[model samples]
Target chain A: MTVGLVIVSHSAAIAGGVVELAGQMASEVTIVAAGGTDDDGIGTSFTRVGAAFESADSGDGVIVLCDLGSAVLTAETAWDFLADDARSRVRIVDAPLVEGAVTAAVAANIGGDLDAVEHAAETAWIRAEESVNSGASEAEPVVPTAIDVVTASTVLVNPSGLHARPAAEFVKLAAKFRAAVTVNGTDAKSLLRIMSLGLSVGTSVHLTAEGEDAAEAIPALVALIDSGFGE
Target chain B: MALGTDWALDWLSRTAATIAVQRSHLNTLDREIGDGDHGENLDRGFTAVLTELASFDDDAVPSDVLKRTAMKLISTVGGASGPLLGTAYLKGAAAIVDLPELDGAALVAMLTAARDGVVLRGKAMVGDATMIDAWTPAVDAAARALAEGQSEAEILDAAATAAEEGALATEPIVARKGRASYLGERAIGHRDPGAQSSALLLREAANAAIA
Candidate 1:
């Protein structure tokens, strides 16, 4: 089973809205909302958090993203109440709830383990801050070694370019093998990195891979982009 | 009179009553630097605790009362206070699990655990002008009283007195945590609402001992 996510917020609508937004990019991942009080007021609920944990976890692991201070407290309380074995697999990540949930959902959607899911959630805000500080400067691209390198380039025929949905689809496909792949000089398995490129329609998409599966991965990724992401 | 389940129930009821009476004061304090629901949230939680206390079995232990209070506060109170105070009680209960009665040393242990639980959850330091300011001194004073061979009542009295002083000390210090921290220098000169409530709860604990 893939890692699941629980979004905690003082307001029910905020939590549900975050879940909906994240779910669109990762339809295969389990994302639950644990927000508001039992009476539907604006506050975090321990019972709701407890129930969310039960529903979200599928034996692999669960990651929780919370908004505000009490939301974290409520989520932690619910976590403490879990059985010892169950508690070990649950993580309460300290990150912006919305961004963290979306990235985490995409990671789980791509068959990431618990640590990979948690890492995705944790790095959401850091990457956001880096992009803001860097302004218009592009990240330095890592050139692949000469040995075992496979590469291809194609034009983006999709009308919307590589938006969140298409980026997520691309990342999911890229994560299937052992190849270290990059699309247009960025990690191909990272949804946020792909989306940040902002490659609009008619932009050139370059695919590269370095590993045993480099040959297979490069062709598959090139074909996906060539297909217009089914747009 | 031993500090047993009866004493625990009495302490909790008295705490609920005190919170109900001081609800407005707490809210006013919270409004200065927080979301202004501290008093109402605490009142709601303690009221639920009162209901839970009423259903205890005859053979129930002291920890059971604290555990139920923790659960009620965590679920009913709709703010930071809910989880903060709820964690205090939950950890306090864990400290004294299966104990039929709380002696001076047991009370010290419970208070220490409760304070540590707040520290663990809130990650606030002593001078951060949060509940830690009141709870730390109370736990320290209780431990001191127990070491001096004080009675349970006297130990609780020491804790209550120290907590009051600590709450007052929160004034004039700028907050470094919670919503008040966002205000920076503007938060000075106002007493922490959470510290005030913590002092009030400790006072209720001491009062329960005498009763």
Candidate 2:
């Protein structure tokens, strides 16, 4: 089971719409929206937030993201009411509701645990920062680690190269393994990093894997890239 | 007369009634510096608390009433006020448990705990142009009243007056906390809605004690 998510917003439509958008990429992940007040006005609700936290959780822990001030306050108050066991599993991530929800959902879809899912949501904006420094891409990828390392070279098959869906698919596969896989030296499991590489069709890149699952990770990743990620 | 459970009930009912009457006034204050929903949101919460009051036992203690009020506000009050006020009431309840009647010391303890709870929940302190500004003044006034050997009613009266003055003082300060802070220097000359509401609630508490 994936780590669940709760999106809190002052507006009902905003929260529900975010849940719908994030759900598109993660059909299996549990995402709940606790937005607006008990009367459906534009304010965060304690009851709705508490209910969302209960339903979204499936024993794998839950991460909560909120839009603004009172939303955060109410969520923290709700957290206090949670049982000790449930409290330990719930974490409040201070990130934008829309982007964070989408990022967290994709990470959860790929079997990322609570901490990884939280990181995915929190660091969703890092890709933009990397893109602005385009002059840095000419540098080499990271040197291979001392662990059991496997390396391969693969050509991009899809005419579109690597975009959202294909890149996400590649990352989902790579992240499932207990290995550190990198494409052209950037992290393969990072959706932002992988997409920021701007790999075009027929551009060959070095794929490397280290750690215990190096052999399995490199071949599976290569096959997925070769298959164009089922595009 | 001692500030007993009956006094607590009266205080809550009076506070709710006052909020219902002054809802628009609070909204106007909020509109100037904040979201303009503070009055309406607090009114809705206290109305729910009034409804929940029926569940209280006839011989309920002060702590029980305060606890239920806290829960009701937490559930009904939307926005930052919900958690802030709810935590205040919750801590207020914890401070005076098992006491059948409240004296000056007990009143001071409750107000101090309530003020601390607001700080703990909202993370706002004095000069931040938040409810804590009024609440802190009221708490310190209450403590001073107790030291001066004032009656329970006098202590509450001192707190109410200081709260009112504290709310008025917010008009010239730029907000550093809450939604009003987003306005930066523009927030000056507008009284913080939270501080105004805190003043109103304390005034009602004092009135109830005398009534």
lDDT of 1 by residue, B81-196 (tens): 88899999999999999999998888999999999999988899899999999999999999999899889999999999999999999988999988899989898989999999
lDDT of 2 by residue, B4-50 (tens): 88888888898899999999999999988888988999999999898
Q: Cα deviation in Å at residue A56, candidate 1? A: 1.1
Per-residue alpha-carbon lDDT of candidate 2 for residues A92-137, written as tens digits (9 for 90 to 100): 9977677678789999998889998999898976655556786665
Which stretch of 10 consecutive residues in model 1 chain A shows the poorest summed lDDT?
A: A134-143
Q: Write the per-residue lDDT of candidate 1 for residues A68-103, one digit (tens) a residue.
A: 877888888888889998899999998878778989
* Model 2 regions lying over 4 Å from their true place: A125-161, A196-216
Predicted complexes: DockQ each = 0.72, 0.78
The TM-score values for the models, in the order shown, are 0.93, 0.90
Displacement of residue A155 (Cα, Å) in model 1 is 2.5
